[model samples]
Target: MSRGKTASALDLPRPDTLDAGKQQGAYEALRGAILNRQLPAGSRLPSTRSLAERWLVSRGTLEAAFDRLHSEGYVQRVAGSGTRVCAVIPEQFIAAPLAREIPRRPVAPDQPDAGVQSHVPFVARRPDASLFDLKTWARCISRGLLTVGPGVLEAAHPAGLPELRAQIADYLRSYRGMQCEADEVIVTTGIRHALDLIARSVLKPGDTACVEDPGYLPARRLFALAGAHIHAIPVTADGLDTAQLPEAARLAYVTPAHQAPLGMTLSVSRRLALLDWAARADAWVVEDDYDSEYNYNTAPLAALKSLDSGDRVIYCGSFNKNLFPGLRVGFMVVPNVLRRSMLRTLQLTGHSVGASDQLGLVEFLRSGAFVRHLRASRQAYQARRDALLECLGGHCTVSGQQAGLHFVLWLPPGVEEGDFCSRAAAVGLTLQPLGKFCHALALPPAVIIGYTALTLAQIRFHGRALAQLL
Candidate 1:
């Protein structure tokens, strides 16, 4: 055949020079053809004898080229089927190099920034790790390890361990006034994980979800990820404005016991109104009782679930705040209507809290040690809160100090929220602006200050410094 005819049939150039290592040249020619799709996927190559004669190279060189292609996953070879290009090329699936202008989804303006775990003063929602009772927790962990047997060797219950569930049930009944059994409790990594599971189980694309205007930012993002149309309802001094709840919403998320950034409890009337709205709208309510364990003046109020006569509430709480953040154990007291669906979701997703951690929590709840620890934590936090309050001494307005780990400091008329936080950071003081938590509703300038992670001395010093800055 003529040179042009041979090249056309093979769709590859002939090896330039046999003395320059014909095997390498042949390999390059075939590889280039495959990469450029001149030799399409699954197309058979010519027999080694015929191809060698056509290219004027020895058959051994052609075989060596084929062998290299096969080894690199560029082609497939079978004794009876001959050699063919691979159906899927290995090089085609490699990720492209990073570019400055790659597309990205918009992040929530209120999303927490990096270095959340850093020990910065006045950083909200952080607990004091130094207060954790390590020796007692270590003993409980050892006891928990013994509880694991051959039954859990294959798989753990998707919902959670039975013993841990029962202990959690008892604790909720006594402490939070929630009426739930072991079967109704679904263990999770934390509040965020619980919300994710609930969102997956119930929310459908384009469904409507009502969230507080200055709400938990993560929950809003989760619902949005599920493709729900988020409706930010205004929060008044009483809590979420119940009258503004949409009639067509499929879910309503609230931090009723203590509003997140605002720190106001939902009044009893509004609580009933919310349950009534859920029932009327045929929607599910997610109650995030994130940090109700440390009410300063009065006893912590009963959870919204306790008032959920219509069975519309899904109560979520986490040990991350009460015990330690690293524990990563949380639970949801779901309504009976959602028990099966939540369990099925858990099973399909294959997510379960660590069995050892669950069992250790069970031990912690059983030994009366958890209660003692809470007592100590409350006393320490209360002292810090008082010290900080005394230091501020009418320097600026403070609210939400009645409960939870953080309180809001309302900025004076001339102070800008962003500028105040920036000034605070310049002095090595970390702060969270209240505007960060707002979605659609505009509010007066303010900052959320956390005291639980700081000692009394630190709180006094920082509080005085904040007053001076103000």
Candidate 2:
């Protein structure tokens, strides 16, 4: 019995006049007919023998053309049903309308800085990839593959794999001093993913979201996209100024462990004050604990979530910076009240990270390789930071060097920030101006210099070059 409606005869061009070979010509004709809608989806073509005889081509040639079409998803072949045009064409072959321009949202100024190549010296937030123990990670991945069973292959929980979430919660409890269980932890692609979930779950259009001024611009832009009115609150050396927090804010996004670009630890008093404010105002606090593992001068502070007696803070952290950016595994610990909403948001959005990678991370953490890596990375980054500081001594003032991967280099009085960055660029140096992180708050002239990704020699060379420029 015919499985699909038979297609009408196609007036395909002869292979003899068209391009190189008979098989190629046959494939092109069929593909063109399908795309042009002459041969609509679910319509079966004539048997290979009949089509070959009709086109005056060998049966083998016609079969080969059908094989190509099937491989490329243009057609589907069944044992008794024969070849039918696919229900959907590949997206690339679908011609988009030329008449209308796709609407686009305006990109925020703080969207990833342009022209900063990862290989260039002083590129911020990048880890030293060379230091990663690839062999160990490979072994972990192998073990993870062996553990995959029928359960692992099934539709994963939108919150993530339970084993991986448990591992992350344990790690955070031990290192970040947060009291959390596996159920409280939701696996995400990274901090951005976590923030996106938080914004969607909690915010209504026009709700006020307070973000740190001279802060992480991506966070501000994301909240704005969620239809929240962004209120840029000033950030002092002590971190976000709690005194200026909006009375009606629905959420406050902060980088408390190590402030983004500025690298200040949120003071204990301010952390308490911020939490207090959130409790009173019924607002949520998002703590992006990015790069808190690399502190050199002092012991890493407890995560802001640890101090949340009111359970108002949503703590976020990512392995992307500590391991490698490509890892793309992060987790968030939300309050019990918000978990249902967060999970609902995830279910609606169909957010699921790769199970294999999550399992591999579970192995990585269980084997204690992650802790060993962090210890080694901390020492290496500290050494590189010291080397760069030594080379820049007496040339300029530097701050925010006690922790994190980057520090702020203040321009000498009367030295314009733009001119300094332009001069650096002329010499093939990439410098991120402090002005780029600022919105409403005006800061002194400076540039953010990253050291973790650079080797001691690169740091010394670039540090000297920057000094000479000064």
Candidate 3:
């Protein structure tokens, strides 16, 4: 306290008087000011003499501080610009180090029907459109249009059409091993919308959650935006490694049924172990049963929700794999207790599934069209998965091939995921590096290729191309 006068912040003494501490403190203060946009990108710093005078520091000390900033690329010495801030920083600028930064959860965005074809020559994700029975689908849509009396195209019932819910419930029971009532099914636009709703409703700012590293980036972004602290767990060949689980997280989001980018089922033992962990940790598990319909071999593992003794699992699935991605129809099976709140959320968000589309889906399911579609897509996707594996030969081993639309090619030790992806794209085929999915760890290098949209022929073509490229 300076007598009766309020102490001015700028006039405060240099508390970090030690040489090393003072230099580090100066760097941090200036960096914060620049990052917060207080100092615009091109702004110049005060002269050494001026800064020394203002901060009551020796000229040599001020010069040393400036030199540190310059070496760190935070400031530049231009011919006439007088040491202005760098116009662009490096990619690693301000990026938190793996051990120092809080882990971020990765979440995929809600995909719009319009953008499904945005990246043309798109060879990502599951779907054999050429093999799809478009005539059958057209017939169904036409029948629905003819059957509608009036206002069928109007706004929908907020809770969704009862018929569609019943259909989805039956399908889940028969295929997904879900023991849920129709009333508990809430059809969402996709997983993105469902995740956002769940985060907004169930999680509060600063609540901790766990996500798979080298997992879905969209989930990570969503959880981070909601202000939750994310714990990044690694996904292995048999889904996420629960042994490395972080204890403090209150919730976890996973794609256990079929790990994304690297298609692998959660082993039965790991499934139970993960559920047990959740029970012990008192955390909620959001099981994204992604690409469940596109399994390669015979009977896959049962849904994680199938083993939920506690009302802790929130299950989500989409027809993006089984049917066309443009369908944009995914269902979230909530626990009975959360059903009403979930429905109310859908209503409040005005994201009620379309009545006509839902009715059409009802017709499709009851007529067994959906199952037929699933079976057909399964056979086609399984073929592509095989082709890609066959193409890999002995270059690099593939991971997560028992089920799901895509798999990862764990590259040679020297090859970084980013460099491989960039170099491959330079040669014409777009590939996603596995490292992009990592949140807070030094991710292993691997290329994740999706075989869903590509045909067996395209897979072979790219396989040879990739062989040469790799």
Candidate 4:
């Protein structure tokens, strides 16, 4: 470890006094100081020339140490000047948010967005206003117009593009092992639309639907918006806890392929129980097989619909995760008995996603590009997940990595996930608090780290910074 590079010792911690093992120690210590705001954001660091002289270490050693710090996000480079502490370290990362998690009033669903309740403006989400596959899609769209009748473009089927429906069926049979036909597939904008359709199609405004308590927020919101009373069922390490499901609900929305936030696959036992309960209760099961594309474990699990001999499950799939988020095409395989009602619901809701995009996507699927792209993306996302695990392993206990685009980390009890994330962001890291996914008042503090959108190097870099914030 004796000065691996030509760089000299870093400034602060007086490098000359430290032994080989201690360089790492000094590097970490300084990183903490910057995040803790002791060094103060934007403050210039002593030059390598100055640090070498002060610490009595060779220039090579000091430079290497600074590179480590820079990668970890504590240090930054300026064009004209030398290295500086990153400007605008979030006040809450090291410092606590002034507000408490619990308020005197009950947190209502209709309450204004939480951002409005805080001193800080809402932290904008990562820009996904546009997705990456638009160019390939545009060509397909043009080709679709050439192939289909003018009448296909004239009126919208709330059920979505028919050609897309047919293609979705073919793709599912080839890929996911679902025995569905075109008529069974109800195409919608994406996962959210799938949720809205099921919620609206099945239950009355006041009827209850069992949902994972610590679950996808959009599912809870969509059901609530549709006037269904949401029953928050607990989700365990093996997916949603079917035993915890109450007797009242007539519908249940699930991510059986891989549970969100917790990355657990529904065990064979739980899947059976879930299906049986739905059948016995005469209830609807909306299966959101959202991220089966990026499975890092064994092969992807079959959708609940695939196992539904009783025909209780309505399974949904989409290209959002396989391609990009805004592809705006997803299909559902509802029970044949409910087809008319589901289609009627789709029509009433105006969930038409235009036929052109669907046809282009169908063509993309038929060409075998969709499968090939998934194979490539699977490797890419798995590598990113590995980087996230490796970089953050020494800092936090990581969880939920078997499948899907993101994973969850349980912050220590006294720690505040949101507060740490804000601080980390000031230094250019974007980690969402785990608690952000929770719907309950007494939710545990955690953060959901999404790795699909970033490169492995980026994951290592930003994840290291986020680890420091933790």
Which candidate leads in TM-score? 2
Per-candidate TM vs. native?
0.75, 0.77, 0.71, 0.69
Alpha-carbon runs more than 4 Å astray in model 1 = 1-115, 147-150, 153-155
lDDT of each: 0.86, 0.86, 0.74, 0.72
Per lDDT, the best of the predicted structures is 1
Question: Mind sharing the TM-score for model 4?
Answer: 0.69
Give the Cα-based TM-score of candidate 1 against the true structure: 0.75
Model 1: pairs clashing at backbone N, Cα or C within 3 Å: none
Error of 1 at 55 (Å): 61
lDDT of 1: 0.86
- Model 2 per-residue lDDT at 373: 96
Candidates ranked, most accurate by TM-score first: 2, 1, 3, 4
Which 10 successive residues of model 3 have the least lDDT summed? 1-10
> How well is each residue in 82-110 modelled by candidate 4, as lDDT tens digits?
77887765444677666757657876777
Local distance difference test, candidate 2:
0.86
lDDT of 2 at 255: 92
* Residue-level error in angstroms, candidate 3, position 41: 61
